[model samples]
Target: MYALLPVSPLYAGLALVPLALLLFTLVVLRWRAHEAASVGMFAAAAVALAAYGLSPEALSVASGKGVWDAVFVLYVIVPALVFYHVIERADGFEALRTRITAFTENELFLVLAFGWVFVSFMQSISGFGTPIVVVAPLLLALGVKPVYSVAIPLVGHAWANTFGTLGVAWLALVQVVEMQSVAATALALGVLLWIPNLVGGLSIAWLYGRWEAVRYAFPMVAVVSLIHGGGQLAAVTVIPPEFANFFAASVGLLALAPLAAWSRYATPTDAIERRPVMAESIAATDADGSSPTAVADGGTATAADAADPADDGLMSLPMAALPFVALAAAAFVTAVVTPLSDALGSIQVGLSFPEIATSFGVVTEATAPYSPFSPLTHPGTFLLLSALVAFVVYRRKGHYEAATARADEPREAFSRTVLATAIPASIAVVSFLVMAKVMDHSGQVLVLAESAANVATPATYGFFSPLIGSLGAFMTSSNTASNILFGGLQQQTAAQLGGLSEPLILAGQSAGGAIGNAISPGNVILGTTAAGIVGREGDVLRVTIPWVALVGALVGLVIVALNAAGLLGVA
Candidate 1:
């Protein structure tokens, strides 16, 4: 039987309906991610059932897969929320701010340190929009203008999206594409991201102090990008992709303090002529949590001379930093150490379903277990353990003052965390995954790939591959979901091209998806909401789109060069 008006251009065109609706509600209607995604999911289901001839049982199984996928997503998100709350309540963020500021008083280096290095580091540990939530406020507290505060982190963290949040995006890419050369794909992705890391550092500097400031901070930018990119390349070669961002960003953060201390990139001795006064940069926030903006006259404040406010007689550096340190260490050991990986991985848990076939003759294979989530080894576990360890340490250090301890109260913290994240996040996860499942099981994605393969030449396709991945994320607002939606398509299209490198194509896709995050409305809104600019989403997107497009194009060029060299499919 024909499915969805036959496997032709017509059916492929039908496949786009769900995606179009998703983009419409999300971008034009300005709907929340969950709401738009839910609407899209239903639209996808209808297409699958009526046009594609999906059996009810198969559809049910697909929905089950989505919920199972949601479980994997929520495991990381819920724990990350708790972990962030734990740190915020204990004034760990303030401690971090004080330590970084003490390292360098220069505005340029400080922006690079927090906006580039630290933002990437946070993305590694707590992704899915967590980095912006944490780093944007840190920038604001450091006296950065609201627009710069929000925009800088969005740009700074773009390079880390695929490997960040403990490789959630990487996992999704591999799982959907079902590739054998995962290590090769990881290496290619790490190499491809070199441009973004380097460009992002320079971009941050320029955004802060313009072209002159970029020149001043140029050395730091080069060094930071090398450390970050090199670390990721080395880590992916040795370990799993999940640890790539954490390992690399850590190397970058460690290297940054020394570079700032020695280089004197923006020190008063070198650049008194062009320094932007630190105080004049911080936008005064309104009490109603409206958009905090820069002063019309660019006035200065006395607070610039003071270090970020610290808790009196409490919250020392080690006490505050130890929890995060533990978080990295735990996630690393559980994932990298073979014995621990096997031991923890053995306790696999998830749902299982029998195979079902649609009337269109598309068959989903039976699986004993699906979307398996390991309790001990998962990032969620690491985050929880880190939170508990930090909590005990903070209590021991007397960090729980009644006035400063809003996040310290367990009931309030948990309640607030759930109330804040549960609805929007959970809805987004389930609906998006269901949408992906319906499209995938209905053979819509395969037909789309076949169509692309028919029209694209190997060389030109390489030039546009990353752009394809970017489109997926722009619609879905998740690099992981982007991978799930298009990873198989990329692989199939690469296979059809004969000499084209599948890994390289995958790399470009991953890189494109990462960069796409900068312009993703869902994420931009997250940053805006955090920075108290809930209505100026257009302002954030206007700046981010140009950066993302330029970087994505650079990645596409790299992919084409690799294709010409015959290195793409060398394996």
Candidate 2:
């Protein structure tokens, strides 16, 4: 008996049913993420057992793996939320908004600063949808419409999905596929990803003011894209892939100062006052006489002020940014400093699973230390460190006030905020991961990829490759998971098609996975939950779906051209 189902259209269509149901619930039924994901998880389990010949033991193993993966992600999500709430409680967002507006009240600059630049930075250091969850509310506090706040960051930081988060996704791809030269593969992915990088910046501008915003922001966008895309490529040549996004995003952050100082962006234009992306209620309030700062803080003193007054004192921009600065420093010491990383990475935790096989012969090999996690070197460790640092600093500075005069009251408040946000987000992420694992372990993922590859000639395989990768991400809501799920299949397909370039195909797969983050339901949930619009995930998806489709198509074309031009090894 075959270890897996033979490639066939019927099986492939069956494999897609779970994802189809997921989309139906999320988009058509307009269900909440956690609710929809639970239904989809059950659907995936049913499909695996009924159509794919998944055994009970194998299903249990896959579900276990899913929960473990969810733990890894939640480690980051919970700490990040703690950090956000810690800052928000201190009125740090209001203070930061005030300071930023003092420098430039141009809505375009502000949007790009938070949505594009800052979100990219966050992705670079800490991904797993951390950037979207953290930055969406920051944008909201800057007075961006709630939907736009979540949607913009969803689109903005997606280009960094592969190499960001300390290159976890890229590392996953490398692990799954036996590439001839890792450097060449990284370089190829870097080049292809630049298109999305440039497109992301311009898209944020367009979202702000249509074509007019794009025209005005073109020069700045170009410059930032160079630093972001070009810098990452350059870093890949000299340094390890792990620090590629970190270096580029840090440079991009520094460049913001000079870019903001430029005459065009520094002077407020009529466009600033006519923010098409903002809510009409807020716009009218701005027109009537309310300062943009007041509108930014929820349109009244009682909203943000009555909750936590800034009367004590406003923190300077640097003071407000200290937690992030600490996060960056911690990441640098652990990731970049060779001696420290080695020492800290030595202590790792992982689980062992027995080899499990389905009746259809789909066998998942047993492995020791599967997906080992280094507690000291993991991003979550750094996030927690940063949170502690922020709490201590802010507390020392008298930034927090308690409703009750108890010493542990602040700790209680932090716990409540974290639980309120982290619980729903965790449920959704776990459900998505579980569904993806069931599909993978049961051979449904392979069947889907092979079926697509079966129909495409070598000439056309390039186009379908990324779509397969995107499908993986749409299901899993993670570039790393997408790459792991499809990377080997892509490699096998490339070899089977004698005319195809393995590196180009794999690059397209990774690039497509990166762009797929825009449409991932789990990521969309993170954004909506953080932005305080949990049920409106469909609203945000409406905006991001087109961008993902457009960019995925563009990536396909680029792969087709490169493959045709015989630039396989060079790219």
Each model's TM-score, in the order given? 0.78, 0.89
lDDT of 1 by residue, 1-571 (tens): 2233255778778888888887677667767667777888999899889888788888898888877766665666566656766776666766666655566667677777888898898888766576775566567656665556678899999899999878989999888887758877888898998888888988887776677888878888888887888788888888877988888998888887578668565353345334342435333333444323333322111233453333454466677678767976785566557897898789988778888777667778888787577777766777789989988878776775632644343445555645465456656767877787777777666565556556678777877788878876765567887888788778877786777888999888888889988876556656654554544455566568788889988998888898899874643
Candidate 1 lDDT for residue 32: 62
Per-residue lDDT of model 2, residues 1-571, tens digit only: 2444767878888888988888888888988778888988898899999988888888989988888778777777777777777777777777777777779877688889899998999889777787887788778777677878889998899889999988989999999888977888888888888988999999999888888889889988999999999999899889998789888998999999999899899866774344556654353556566643343422112222123333336778998889878987887667657789899999989998779877778898997867888888777788789879988998888777531232333454556767876788789889988998898888888888888888998899999988988888887788998998889888887887878778888989998899999998778877776776766777778789899899898989888898898885632
The Cα RMSD of model 2 versus the native structure comes to: 4.1
| Deviation in Å, model 1, residue 517 alpha carbon | 5.6
Candidate 2, 179: how far from true, in Å?
2.4
Candidate 1 Cα outliers beyond 4 Å, as residue runs = 1-9, 119-190, 206-213, 230-250, 266-311, 402-414, 469-492, 499-503, 513-546, 565-571
State, as a TM-score between 0 and 1, how close model 2 is to the true structure: 0.89
* Overall local distance difference test of candidate 1: 0.73
Weakest lDDT window of 10 consecutive positions for candidate 2:
297-306
Clash list (residue pairs), candidate 1: 4-51, 501-568, 501-569
